[model samples]
Target: MTGNESRVAIVTGGSRGIGRAVAERLAADGQSVVIVYAGNEAEAGKAVAAIEAAGGNAAAVRADVADETAVRAAFDLAEQRYGGVDVVVNAAGVMPLAPIAELDLDELDRVHRTNIRGTFVVDQQAARRIRPGGAIINFSTSVTRLNLPTYAAYAASKAAVEAISPILAKELRGRDITVNAVAPGPTATALFLDGKDEATVERMSKMNPMERLGRPEDIAEVVSSLAGPARWINGQTIYVNGGAA
Candidate 1:
């Protein structure tokens, strides 16, 4: 509740890729946005500028998703600037590919810290502060179902994320707030395409029934539905992977 203004949204990792798309789409939908990024402040600023250019209100804040205090400050900024938050998209995540046997413990910890712990931190803040009728969207990955090689630890962490989404929805019962996870399949983001060769990308793309990599906008559209006008669709993980999983 604005008590009457446009609802505010906090999109973590909003500086680039899918997160950037989510921020833009939500702002375009008429909500004031806080684009939270762990780094790449320049990209974050650009995301804010893009929203402003589109006649939407947005601000960028820097915060490590796993850091509770910094996340709280980001929420504080949203409240101060836009009145109160009504949506939170926890899209901040890290993926370092390795099989379980050879996986670096440090890398696993980092991924888990940002993926599992980060979701928990952001959800905690949203659960505490979001106005009634709000939505909390967390990002998981289709790899959990795909069982792809070299994604063991990454999948494991996101599996934890998937496991918690519905639990939080129940916890927020009677609050009229919805909690859900969006598990995207292989998408054409820098994070996904950076290391692979074109053939590899092609193979992954064809894995989907659609026979193409999911576009950032495609995923953003799903987020828009959840963040804005999809109140009845709560506590479920809507896999946006084109049935690859």
Candidate 2:
């Protein structure tokens, strides 16, 4: 592949869910992928194997997205293995539901450590090291807009993500790097459906005009577009939730 066509990417939390889909999509789009996971080395290996089986270039790296040193090593692996980083999708995050009245501070801390601090750590690296024309995509939630009752802490963390995306984009003025965030609604990922009952899930499905839960591939499509040809879409928080909010 030509240099421009063979862009390389690092997808955090890429061992599962929307991140897994994003890794596969980017590889299918001709980018060499480095799938970054917080843990789950086996799953990370599986993701790499799937990409290789599909005749795409890929590797797996383990790093806590909130840990600066680990994140640096992950980026180092991407640069060392795939030549350089062209796209960084900060898809690593946590979502623990709780109302403000019954909030669990420890869980909130854990969520923020992974979701909010993680974005900051990862994006700081992307800002410092990503090549010109690179794209940095952070994951957000439609819950921020939907204002769902039990997602207070999760949405608050993502609100910080939304705040950082545009600010970083503006900071990268002449570098041609685009920093953006993708806010997804009730996507059919284990992370989203884990605690919900069938009735609750169905109710959420009805919130959007589409009357269905979003698929991981749906969100992957948006990431792919932003990472590749969607140059004009800089510093934007795109809601890919099918009119959920």
Candidate 3:
């Protein structure tokens, strides 16, 4: 990629929450963005519209991140639309909270299917397609370090993400592409706020020195850096938790 070239990006789970924020940030930074959603066409359209309204190039593709064929089509669209893909952010994930003893097998499978297999499928495509000087950013979670109760299934899936990212970075040795994971702590997204009561949210908020849940934009800032100028920061999992962990 040349200095004058505009980077192109594919962001999985780009319809809402942190993923949406990342997509917008990348677009704002002059990258052509393809917002990939599992089923939410409305949300995906909104994200694309928002980016376009801001004078950035964007499109939305509906695809299951765990489905290889669908993900490949998404990549093919990005390449066809924006010349070539320069970055991919695997922010697609599922979090089903349950204690180890009570966790249902079906729920475990659902969480792993999305969080583990989904990440792998997307990262696999990224490894095969992203151009040199590009990046693959996967999402992990601070729960892996917090050991929070009732997060066993969710935490385990993210632990796999943290493990695989560095190995993938090394595997792409001469490709000049960077691979890394961003682990966010208690962020204020629908995914994080859905089941918890006000009291639980309050407790988690204070756990961080910042005394509040992280904003999607805060995490996006780090992702923006990794996707662009932070070329040397490879094969690592960055904890964006305001020192919570």
Candidate 4:
């Protein structure tokens, strides 16, 4: 937190869910936030407005993190707007569930491209451009550890991310930057609840020690802490999953 008040942060998939919450929280903590969304201009705009109304600085940028060119441009936008980028939260991802034998190869490929490749693209940019003392926070899911049925493909994608992050941290050793991942449990986001029955949802919630679904804000708090004064936390996959794993 020793940086200028105008420090810039780029949050992918910032239009909704945990990404939106992270963007708003970072803005509230005095960073100029760049909200990156894939296909929802309106949701992104609303996120910006919410930050602005809360007396925090933010702007919405349209980009698919899985696309290298788009992600490069998003980083460029942040640097141009605030002089330098200080933090990057790779919250953009997809979760399509199916048993191994029943899983569509197309669906598996899509998840891998977005979750695994997208994380690499963003981390590469952050490594090269982010200021010293900056943070690179990636997203993973608790399902990696939970080993839930129908989560094989999705979990595999995140498991790749979990494996890569620590190496990135070591690679950036001299830079004083921290690279980490946050693995959230079953959260009550639109994506997580979609197609699930009430009984199923409640049962999933009960799996956690907290005995309830996670809120987007709950995950945001972890991101905010890592991105700010808590610089000592590096190369760790912090599970903010209510001990569900």
Candidate 5:
């Protein structure tokens, strides 16, 4: 895309992992990027600095995606800094796993608040503020389909995201916008690897047909395509799960 034709993108949870990768890819693709992190100021700063070093315009903003005021402020900052937002990637999520019998309700609430409610806050802002022909990309996980033993709560939350995506797409029909979700399989991220032993991680990696866990950049590639000139793709959940589900 030409520099003038490039749009501005806001990537939530963008300090690290999949979010970071998506932010970098968007910046590289010529879209001015705003990277939103919850608490990691250092990591956020590093992301912004890297983008600048690579000749891409970027800024880091701190916000809890689950907070309406924070989410709105993030959008406002993007608008003030870059005129308007054309793309939003909702990559902020939490994935604590436990069997249903042992699941902690408090932890469940936290996950739901961030993954489901957080998605709504960001998506609502994008719906209201995004330019015509802009795109809204939400994150889901292949675990929703895999139905792993300990993923009950997490899957339920993501299932809610999947449920809302098509409706939002239809809601934005007249405005020439697209709303979609990307469901990734086993990916190598702190969130995915945390608490898992090497054997567990290796087993998860082998679950994919590709015989390896996904890289953040792999998911970023999908986000890049959806945010670009491919306006024809709308109201769909595209799986970037390496055929895992």
Candidate 6:
């Protein structure tokens, strides 16, 4: 593909929320997109339909990000159909909040399995198969810095993501690929809003100087820059938190 024209992207968790927004934005920027969702075929269909309705090319694939085989298949599909993938956004994550003392061991394992292992699995495939000049954007949370209560397990998992992303960037030195993490704070998505009371949501909104929660489109803008022309920005965890941390 010349420039953004006809380039391709693979966006995990693209069926909804930030992933969906990123997929739509990349497609709008002229890249074909593969929306890799865990389940929720209906949501995946909606994302693809929205992209196609906007005159962009997109498809949906159901795969567990933590599953190496499934992730590889997702990559294979992107390569086989679009020639190659130019961007891989590892946005599939699960957050079950609880204080460290009360957190279930099983839940901690589940969180790590999806957030940490999933990031590694998707990043591995991206490192292996993505075309040069590609970008790998992983998701993290500002809680690692905010040190919020009831976020120990989730924060710990994302901290691992932050640690590894930069190392991967260095390891891919000769290749023209960028590895980075987007750590958003208090974004307004089902992932973040679910189970949160109105008062709790308001409290988070006021924590940021912006006095408002981030939109999915807000995060998408950053990803768009990284995936396309922001090659100088590598091995960094950008805190897209409106100065919350």
- The models' CA-based lDDT, in order, is 0.94, 0.94, 0.95, 0.92, 0.92, 0.94
Clashing pairs in 4: none
Candidate 5: what lDDT? 0.92
lDDT of 5 by residue, 66-139 (tens): 99999999999999998899999999989898999999999999999999999999999999999986899999
Each prediction's total of clashing residue pairs, residues at least 3 apart in sequence or on different chains, is 0, 0, 0, 0, 0, 0
Select the stronger candidate by lDDT from 4 and 6. 6
Off by over 4 Å in 6: 1-5
Displacement of residue 45 (Cα, Å) in model 5 is 0.6
lDDT of 2: 0.94
Q: Which stretches of candidate 3 lie over 4 Å from their true place?
A: none
Q: For candidate 4, write residues 1-245 as lDDT tens digits.
A: 35345778999989999999999999989999999899999999999999999999898888878788888899888888877899999999999988999999999999989999999998988988999879999999999899999999989999999998999999998999999999999998987998889999999999987899999999999999999888889999999889888
For candidate 1, the per-residue lDDT at 190 reads 90
Greater-TM-score candidate between 1 and 4: 1
Q: Residue 68 deviation, candidate 3, in Å? A: 0.5
Candidate 1 global lDDT: 0.94
RMSD of 1: 1.0
Better of 1 and 5 by lDDT: 1
TM-score of candidate 3 on Cα atoms, chains taken together:
0.98
Better of 3 and 5 by lDDT: 3
